[model samples]
Target: MMKRFLILSALISLSIFSSDKIGRLPVYKIAVEAVPATEEGIVLRDFIKEQIQSTSRGTISLPLKESESGNWEFDKEGNPTLETVANIKRYTDTDKLVLISTEDGQAVISFVDVLHRKLEYRNSLPDSLSKTLVSDFLGFLDKKNIYLALSETGSGSNAQLKINSLKPTYVAGEPIRFEIESAEDNYVYVVLVPENQKGEPILLFPNQIQNDNFVRKGDRVTIPDKRISFKASSVPSKDRIRAFASREEWKEFQLRGKKEDSFYRLLPPAVTGTKTTARSMTVVPNTLTASIEQSPVMEWEYQILSR
Candidate 1:
């Protein structure tokens, strides 16, 4: 009887860990409202909707109508009223309600948390409706969520990876240094992804140069050591560094066809099997065959400004 109970407990733990490794994202019901009548308003609304869907990896639900309480109200200028904002904060079912309004050629975006009844994020554009403006807004949203999720998932994990840069920003032609640390003995893989490019992530470790991605438990590893350095991209853009650690060896499966150029691509099966869309330049552990039950992944973002 005791052996059966132990087996059942192990199975339950494996189920929970496997679900997370396979990219089961937390679902959120998001409400969006924008002054769709005007050109700028339409642009803001469409961009927000598309970006939310993409960044959330389709984990968000968009309802066509407002909540039953009907507390969401907008002024004649299409701005959210204080009472409306309060009502959205008071509501519990909705995850967030995004309100976008443009006035005097400037766009304002606000993210309200209905459960917490607090203003999550508020930003005003610099009186322009360019693609860069939209990209910046979307990047802000993606970065915020990505960091928050990573923090929550990484906390209290048996095996974890943390990445830090030598500097806050990098310039063209400069070599960048990264400090990596792991909480447990695991094989660590690091990949550097430049957001401006549409190619495979540059594998920083376990390559021809280093040939070693294994780290001892509670050990600190630095990439591009004193003798070597990672060169910055010529183009200026936001980039990200993802570190995936596992108790077992991980093998990356390459994809064919149009993604042929991407050497580090995850196999099609891994993409289709996962619940969330995989990010470019990051490895999904479920794509790899490992004997272990838990595989944890973490990521950090930085900027590369043009000189």
Candidate 2:
């Protein structure tokens, strides 16, 4: 597993990559389990919303009602009955309906075409899996992978996140190298924001490693090279911070608001390392300091070093 952290709001923004043109039909409704109302549900909803819009090339509206066990009545053989489906279909006046369920480490998506009265697709996703489960089912319409369709859908769908590729040079900075050996190819995002008197603190994925972006007092520079717009200086003695992510121009996976300010926050708690371990490198700025944990690149030392 790649130590997954679901940013529910990220999906709500629907600003990330989406899969369009999976099928000609526009997706209108997505019914999720009642769990979406919880803290965890928020994250799952964002990812799901992003998936629906991207894959279906249509707008998606999530039904507000909580799902009940009887919401999807199965027949004696365990297949959902048409009669039971009719009840579900009455809520959303859309052409399609998606039934979503989640278990220990995976999410099950069932795409039902109400008009056709058939299950268009079904798939089970593993925990910490990189592939988007939402897009997978939508892509099934045209027999395509959501990941592949995301780049192809383009402007036909509004769910695309644009990424610009650029090169960055390390400048006397403490670099965090995160090697999620078992994680998916999802681009990691890193940001350094001025917090306290110690100046800006660095945050990274694979929170296991110690890597921070470095900059001089007067250096008008932003690393990862593409998000200079957000990094531009602020007035009123505002603290200037440098933010970075695995992918620049992340219109696809954007947060609806300041993630830290949301009810559902980004929690980087300590978890036992499984098959994959994350690492990072950080160079300090000026005489500022940082404390690193058990990272191999940091000489296996636990100490707070000043720049």
Candidate 3:
């Protein structure tokens, strides 16, 4: 039996692609998780405030909307907690957040991406702030583009992953085959979203039958390696496909219920951050060089039509 999400080539395709009930991706928002009340924290907060509103100061536009979240909640490790990070997502219209606090008497700042679920670790005030502050502050909204970012790693990864042999289009009842080419070691998952775009997408790989998602680098994995088959849907629709590969083993948060041939249903990523824990990519402040690691995320969209 296949795990779920992935359909067996022999099983006829059905319907299931939808982005969000809103009929489109939702716009993201930003917020200030909290500013420290300590003398250093206050100073840092003032500096940030003066910078972000400079663009609107004398202009006809509105001031930077700032919410002073009461206080900071630290975990046992002394770093900000995930629940605190989630607070911004839960309480505000912002998709991103800037947190200011004093760490060991030094003023530090962290950039939290609520949508992507990452925190750019703290950096010293002197080394981080500058004239471009406002632009950078508001620019968080466009900071990450999944389609483009996942496609280009800024640098080709050691475990380069490729999706190939998929036809640009497919018709109902037709056999569909594709290849997931990658380096010696990497984990991967693929999702199919039907044209209707109404609910969760279908997981296409790592099914019960093919439960092992791990493959060596430079490996070319073919769907339906077995004699059984997978055919296009008898019902016509334009569907989308998303695949993710990384050195780290990862899985999307799935909903609980009856399984379709043991296939799992994934939560919508845009709003609920279903795969937010997985790397969508986060960057630290300047004066910090990023070490090479994590493929971040990957996706592909294909047109499957039925006549």
Taking all chains together, each candidate's TM-score versus the true structure is 0.42, 0.32, 0.40
Put down candidate 2 lDDT per residue, 1-307, tens digits, no spaces: 0111111001011122322333323224445443324444456656666654553434565564544335565544435686666565665566556565556767666666555455656667774652455434433432212112221222222211122221121112223121211122223333332212122122332132212223223323223233111211211111211222222223222122232321111211111111112220011110010001000110010111222
lDDT of 1 by residue, 1-307 (tens): 2111111100001011212434434234677766333667667777767766654522454544533344445544445677776556544556666767777878877666565455656668765544445544444443334323322233225337666554656666667677788878888766554453333345556544455778987788778555544566556656656566867665443222232221232232324333132242133222232312235666566666666
* Candidate numbers sorted by TM-score from highest down: 1, 3, 2
Candidate 3's residue-wise lDDT over 52-83, tens digit each?
A: 33322111122233444544455444445665
Clashes of each: 1, 35, 32
Q: Best by TM-score, which number? A: 1
Clashes of 2: 35
The parts of candidate 1 lying over 4 Å away from their true place are 1-22, 26-28, 35-39, 55-58, 63-82, 89-92, 154-214, 217-294, 297-307
The number of the candidate with the highest lDDT is 1
Model 2 worst lDDT run, 10 consecutive residues: 286-295
**Candidates' C-alpha lDDT:** 0.51, 0.32, 0.45
